[model samples]
Target: MLFNSAESQTVNIYLDDSSTPAYSVAGCGRQNDNRGTVVLTSGKTGTVLVGVCSGENACALMSQAIDISPPSDNSCVGVVASSTAGGDTNSAYVILTWKATS
Candidate 1:
């Protein structure tokens, strides 16, 4: 899902990776605060791809690397928004795709 729109606002998307879901991230961006990309691998092993777009107030977009190792069977993750220099207000979006890798 690629979430995009208001640059000054903030939105949160919940994830359930209890079954270990593989993924390819793109689109869904962030603003104001950092974005959280959680990858849960319980009973299976998977991955998460995150795309942090640029917001209005923020000077730039969030491009961070979030990964998992050892093939997690159970875990969680949270990517905080990147602190930009200038305070503009040009919102952005992010995209995420999860698939069971059992």
Candidate 2:
């Protein structure tokens, strides 16, 4: 994540229809140590929700449904998730990359 503002941002990741986040991080924009691994069955689709906040207000939010279809010969694939916050003037960005092990 790219942090431009003085205050750090919080990021939360939710899978499916769960009300609680599957993963969460505080002060995420300040460092590069934020990372996690999730396993999903191949040949299936799932919804992912990502939310970013600074204090009591929300800075960014995104939700997308992804299909996990690995090659017949490959056991893993790379996936990248990206989003931006704080609008045009003072925007911050979050990027997440991981290897999908199906």
Candidate 3:
């Protein structure tokens, strides 16, 4: 899921080795929460790339490696990424969560 706080920006999400975004969310002006799911084999790992764009130009970029593992029973695991120092104004953040499905 992506939670974009920047009032006039857009957040783009990309999966490993992909040149195109897998998901995109407009800033608070349009939407606040955008969610998606990616399923990977157990013990598999990949990269997540994020682009914060102001119009057609990128204002900030972030990347991280992600490892998939089942969460505890009845619980979800989450990872968060924030742009800028202390997540100042015009910054965007993403929360990636993992949970086991029946």
Candidate 4:
């Protein structure tokens, strides 16, 4: 989750078995757990850490994302999720938090 603009270096740290970690929200800006991707904007650029949280926890989230830099805003993901239990439909409430460190 660190990016060095000086050398144009980027790193995304992933934990566990590729399953999104659930973060708890006790205060504000807690991760959203449902299923979705994030796209950075506003002239910002860097690595984005995607996190997902459960409905019963605070600051608890399961997150992961690709180290991508789209020339015209591309390499999108999770635009659709399983409405059921096996990713078979579109799942809403899936929020994504992104930080573009430039």
The numbered model that scores best in lDDT is 3
lDDT (tens digit, per residue) of candidate 2 on 1-102: 445444555666677777788777665434334444444322234556667776667764443334447534333222233334445222344454345455
Per-model TM values vs. the true structure? 0.27, 0.48, 0.47, 0.22
lDDT, candidate 4, equals 0.28
lDDT of each: 0.37, 0.50, 0.53, 0.28
Off by more than 4 A, model 1: 1-45, 56-73, 85-102
Order by lDDT, highest first: 3, 2, 1, 4
RMSD of 2: 6.7
Local accuracy of candidate 3 as per-residue lDDT tens digits, 20-66: 77776665432546645554322334566666765555665454545
In model 2, what is the error at residue 2, expressed in angstroms?
A: 4.6
Per residue, candidate 4 scores C-alpha lDDT tens digits across 55-102 of: 322222333444456543434333111122223221223333444333
Q: What lDDT would candidate 1 get against the real structure?
A: 0.37
For TM-score, candidate 1 versus 2, the one ahead is 2
RMSD of 4: 14.2
lDDT of model 3 at residue 52? Answer: 70
- Model 1 lDDT-worst window of ten: 18-27
Steric collisions counted per model: 24, 0, 0, 23
- Could you report the Cα RMSD, in angstroms, for every candidate shown? 10.1, 6.7, 6.7, 14.2
